[model samples]
Target: MSVLAHLGVEITSSTDDSMDNRKRPAASPNSGSFVFWSSSFRRQPARVLIVEALPPWWSDTCTVLCDALDNFLSLACNLDGPSRIPLLSLYAVSRQQECVLPFVQVRGNLARLHSCVEELRSIPGEGCIKGAARGGELLRQAVLDSLQQFKQYIRHISTGNQTNNNLSVEITVVTSQPGPGIVRQLEMGLKDADLVSLKRLLVVQINSVGDWGQDTPSPETTYTEAEESLMLGTEVELLRMENSVFALETMLKAWLQEQGGDREHLHLLLPSPTDSPNPVCVKCDMQERLISPALIPLTPNLGVKTESVRDFLPVTKASANQNQPPQRLKVIKLLRADGLCESVLYGLPLVIRPTTCWQLDWEEMETNNNLFHALCHTLRGRDLFLLLQVEPAGGSGVYSHYVLQSSTSLSLLLKPVVSRELLLPCSMPVSPQDPVPDAMQTVQCCLTQLDEEFVFNPLSLTNNLYQHLKSRGLISQPRYPYRLQPAAVLRDQSQPPEGAKTTGSRQPRQVKPHSFLQQCEGHEVT
Candidate 1:
């Protein structure tokens, strides 16, 4: 009967003769009790325990653990599905006795853990066991014993269905003072349990006091050993943390990396400094030199604020639209005699009136337009004419002339000329009474004078003429060839003669003359 039952056979008759003669059909393996047990076992919840080997007074060890736990809880709360809640346990080891806090799924468990850690925090070093010489050994023994008991409990529960057992267990051991023996023992125990398939095993070493030496085992040793001991799918991390928020961030990033979480995209929500009732002044000599208030440091210590995970959904959505191309406006190219050009576009309200003419208010211009400022600076104290060309949709061009005026703000104040003929012959005059000589005529005269002074190379005549004209300010800076537009000529008998003046307009008014050529000549025209 026992053999038949093992083969998934059911027996109705109890007589020994009938049992010996009974025959039952073989059942499928998937329908057996073992398969059911395996499926049920795989669905079991995960268990995580944070084990602290060092005492509370060991250089902010307790505080670091509590901060880590708070980060973990924040991560849990932000989880999307049913995995948000995890079964958590805490254990604290000391020379006197080991304290085991059982796993609980209640909301108050975190509060209880915080209170327990605080109570442990209040206990001074004098209250601890006086066996300072054997403290490291005792702590190692306690950790080994606890791991052994945990393994035994798991094994005992999985006695009958050992092949189908799929429970996952994770233990995070955080310590500042780890004995060499403890690390070796952990390495050996984890190596032997490779087939048991533990979920995760992380060892965090806090170096608050900075006493690492030959006696103390380094984190690299544990990391290399743990990598070799753990199963292919299992995770093992060996982290070392200093007393800083950046160190804690590194630890959390490592933890999330093992779980296949997006480490780079996560943001930490820190408490706002504005929450304090009184304003605090943070002083720094280097920061004081910066003009922007946003660049100044608000506090020297960032660890005072608690950190939590801010979800990535809203941040992702906000950034998704951030990279849209900037809107472009229609702009006209304004070229200068110096070969420097600027793009003119309206960024503010453009008003054209008889009073203001085409005055551009510098204060109203966009502060970001650096080209405008550069053009304004270059055009200062110079007489220039702008040839305005507008191409209409009918493929016809409309042309006009505007005298470019420089103001105190160095902005362009364009005064439109009534006749396009005014643009001809480069309308800048050396003085009110004396019109500036034509650029070609001036270049010819300068070349003749240079020829008289010294026998000049015939091949260098054009170059020498440009240099001479540029020095005389007849040609502008950069010395490009200046071409004079043809003057308007009438081809009718009734039209006025070439030099005739119209009757309606008053005679050209002469203002106080300020000659740029006179100033250049005073400086020897060099």
Candidate 2:
């Protein structure tokens, strides 16, 4: 049974004749087959972790790195919004390499992750006496191990599931040793077929203080050198970072940046008229929008904590209306007047731009963009809104958007049609309101004049809950710059005050005073 059913909520999607179906149907010029785009764009490549297990000599660094990894895993598992939780595979490398965890959805797998962390921590140095001497050899072997394990995992999944045959993988390698030997091994091991599935290879070198010499190249140069050596026509990012919590956060931020976590999309394809046979498919990316803040619940029990299945479910690309194939937006109805209210408006609003992905030639793209601007101008001039049936990528849902044009770009305000009536007539006759008083009208005019145009970006804001957790020693600093302060800034504080009282503080019990009012002055009623 699904998690939703376990929670005593039964979700049912129905196909009903709504306003869009009942309205005058528009004629389509194209009678031929509709070419559906591949759903792969909606999904992201799986992330695989290959972290080197440090020996006893690097105990301090090992402790800090393990803690950081744990925090990162927890955060990934409990990410906010309706997006799918990332799938991750964990591998640990020392003198020998071992797969601590296989490909598993990060959501609702905290217990498994904890067990994996334990295994990572317990990994002992192979031949303790020779461990320090064989560090370089271990690093080289680890590189080969990571590549081999990744290939094996990919092959296993491809054989098991045909749909996942084309799935790509993003490999993140965390090692203390970064040298020419490791680079050469990776270059030799990776084949052309392997490169196709490998989206990115992020090498995070955990270095000690004073590891870099005067002749050592910068991180960018290292990345360039690695890419050049691989010669697989693929980019490789190398980050040489110190063994600290701050460095881990930076590594995660860089990794997330590559994963496009910062760049979220609301609707993929723009609304095009059905009359056009070859309608231009304009891909849109969301801007200046904030989702609701979510805090993962901390439970003492071993079982993984879950708030809602919607938060953890894998985000798919199938159309919400399963009967219909993916298309460039469907127009439901055209609004002639401003009759809709806040009651009809549902879900987070999105401001979209056609600057991200496109499936048109340069000449055609320019023409389509010009047409978009014209449409926006027309909508603004006529004070009209287009009610469109938008099936967002990731199978989010079939949402009705009350779309209007801003001076900049198209603004999609999610306003699903309400099935039930909202407004009810009063028993008394309706009375027209008189003209506003002069003083009130003057105040309103002044207020309007004082108003300044301000754009609010949700991505720009930080999560207060996350900050609180960090302050209380419950969580670590977030990976993103917008989410928290930089590592240097965080380190500059030296020591934070202890036992600070914020929200969720325990309050002393209030003592009730003697009820003199109930006693009625001198006369006490029994």
* Structural similarity to truth (TM-score) of each candidate: 0.33, 0.40
Candidate 2 C-alpha lDDT tens digits along 1-526: 0001111111111221222212323222231111111122223566778776655434545666777777666655553222232457787766566677877766566789988887777776433434322544454455455556667765775564333422567778776655443444354445343466677777777775423234343332344555555554555567677778756854553332213443443443322333334323434542111111112222211111123323222334446555333234567766753554433333324444444345578988787777776777776666666776544434433232333323434533223332211111112345698656964554444445343547655577676987787787644544432434458866754443576544556553343334433443565444
Candidate 2 backbone collisions, by pair: none
Clash count of each predicted structure: 0, 0
Error at 343, model 2, angstroms: 28
Worst 10 residues of 2 by lDDT: 1-10
Relative to the unseen true structure, what is the C-alpha lDDT of residue 154 in candidate 2, on a scale of 0 to 100? 59
lDDT of the candidates, in the order given: 0.38, 0.48
Q: Of the candidates shown, which would achieve the greatest TM-score relative to the real structure? A: 2
Candidate 1 per-residue C-alpha lDDT over 188-241 given as tens digits, one digit per residue, 9 for 90 to 100: 444544435355666666666635355544343344655655633444556666
Candidate 1: where is the Cα deviation over 4 Å? 1-57, 78-80, 106-109, 123-166, 178-181, 188-197, 210-213, 216-237, 252-526
